[model samples]
Target: METVRVNLGSRSYDIALTHGATANLGAFVRAALPKTSSVLVVGDSNSWPHAESIQATLTRAGLRAGSAVVPAGEASKCLERLAGLYDALYELAADRSTAVVAVGGGVIGDLAGFAAATYNRGLPLVMVPTTLLSMVDSSVGGKTGINHPKGKNLIGSFHQPAGVWIDLAFLNTLPAREFISGLAEVVKYGVILDAAFFAYLESNSHAVRTRDPGALLRVVTRSCRLKADVVEQDEYERTGLRAVLNYGHTFAHAFETCGGYGTLLHGEAVSIGMECAAQLARKLGLIGDEFVSRQTKLLDALGLPTAPPTRWPADDLIAVMRRDKKAVGGQMRFILPTRLGEVKLFDDVPEPLVRTVLESAVSR
Candidate 1:
């Protein structure tokens, strides 16, 4: 097992990465919340088996544990499902001393984390991420929320988890498309922060595609460590440091919103979003065509989409972008890449230029 610590003074926690770590979740939960006697295991339908096993383990450990399974997918990240979770927790008689164990991908983590953050003021959150996207991004940040009708992640909070347990074994059952979707975020980390990591991914593409254990360990560990360093510097997005983490998210979120939330997976939108950002950067002369080509090649090799789905309208997508959380004073803000391993927050980009890029991405 490998451990990465998020040093946040009193709020600090550890991300434990290992094969079959979920089997030992009972002990891990006990160590993280020694005073807690009850746990609310929240999982999606696809991940309920793991949640069931976890509940059984906790029961054997003499802890009062109950579980509620929600439908899987992006549509579930809404106010209705969130309310359902609150009701379920109340039925479970969960109190402030209760800990929430989130099992599954980003959707489950965000929904359960939000439930834990708001229930009776707050409750401890333990993340058991089953997808690559959650393991690398959402599970560690403490950013939790349900989506509103208007935008993606429009309603959310920064409530950090007490512990994040990542088990490689979960990926064995992960769908191939979902697995490919996750590589987008992994590529994001390399694009915005580590050129060497990006090169490493390029060289080891075959190993990563095959889910070789050693490559996965390195990819996940490095991704978490990079994100933790950023979170440590700007836990709540006060400084612009954390903004870099949204390298392609501004465009991605808009794509998701325009797609009616279920049209494409989050990471699929992100893969295309990153491509758009790179193209926009090229148009602005922030980077050369070579940079865009390299990114496109890598994404293509990873089986990720680099172009917006033709069905989505570019103008409607731009409207959605205006409501992005990063928008300030009704003006847009984007974390644009200046080059691989580097990016900067660019605000108030002209609407015409934005439309031009969106049109190209959509029409291509």
Candidate 2:
């Protein structure tokens, strides 16, 4: 097992990554909180098999596990669904000492973690991320919440989990499209921080698509390391250094909101978003044209969409982008790459230029 520590002062925790970590989840969660008794195991229906195994393990270990399974989709992240989960937790009588284990992808993690954060004035959370995207990103950051129709992650809190358990084996059951979609976030790690990691992906993109264990471990660990390092520096996202993690998310949220949530998987949107951001960078002369081609080619090779299909009205996307929490007042702030390995937030990016890039990305 490869363990990376997310140093967040009092909120510090470790992320354990391995192939078969799910089998030993009971032990890990118990070790993290010996007194944890009643746990609300929140998962999506697609993840029920693993959730069942986890519930059974907890039961065998003398912990009472109550489950709340939601339908699998972005629609599950709603106020009504979240309220229902709170009602379930209340019925189960979950206390502050009780642990909440989120056993699915990013949607479940965000919803369940928010429940843990707000229920009974906050309880301990143990996230067992089953998706590649969640394992490498969402499951650790403590940024938990459901989406409002207005925007993604607009209603969230910074509630750090007790620990995160990453089992790469769960990814084997993921659909090929979903797995490929996940590579978008993994690629974001390389784009924002590590030039060498980007090169490695260039070389090993095939192995990743094939689900090679060695390649999986390397990419997951490297992505986690980059996230952990940034979280350590700015846990609350107040310093703006951590905003680099949103390299492609600015465009991604617009895609999700404008097209409706389920129309594009978050990672799929991000794949296109990254390419769009790269194009904008090139347009601004911040990066060379070669960088844009390299990004698009890798995304194309991975069977992920590199651009939005329809010429979505740039004005509509701009409207959604303006509503993003990262935006300052009405001005748009973006994490734009200056080079392959480094990205910086640019607040002065003209709205006309942004609209032009959005128009270009969709038209192409």
* C-alpha lDDT values of all predictions: 0.90, 0.89
lDDT of 1 by residue, 174-263 (tens): 999999899999999999999999999999988998899899999999999999999999999998899999988888988888777878
**Candidate 1: 10-residue stretch with minimal lDDT:** 308-317
Query: Can you write out model 2's per-residue Cα lDDT over 1-364, one digit (the tens) per residue?
Result: 8899888878888899878756677888888888898798889998999999999988887889999999999898888989988999988988766899999999999999998999887999999898888988898788999998888888989999999998899999999888888899988988999989999999988998899999999999999999989888888899998899999889999999999988998999999899888888888899998898888888887788988867778889999888889998988888999998899999899788888889788668
For each candidate, give its TM-score against the true structure: 0.98, 0.98
Q: After superposition, how far is residue 296 of candidate 2 from its true place, in Å?
A: 1.2
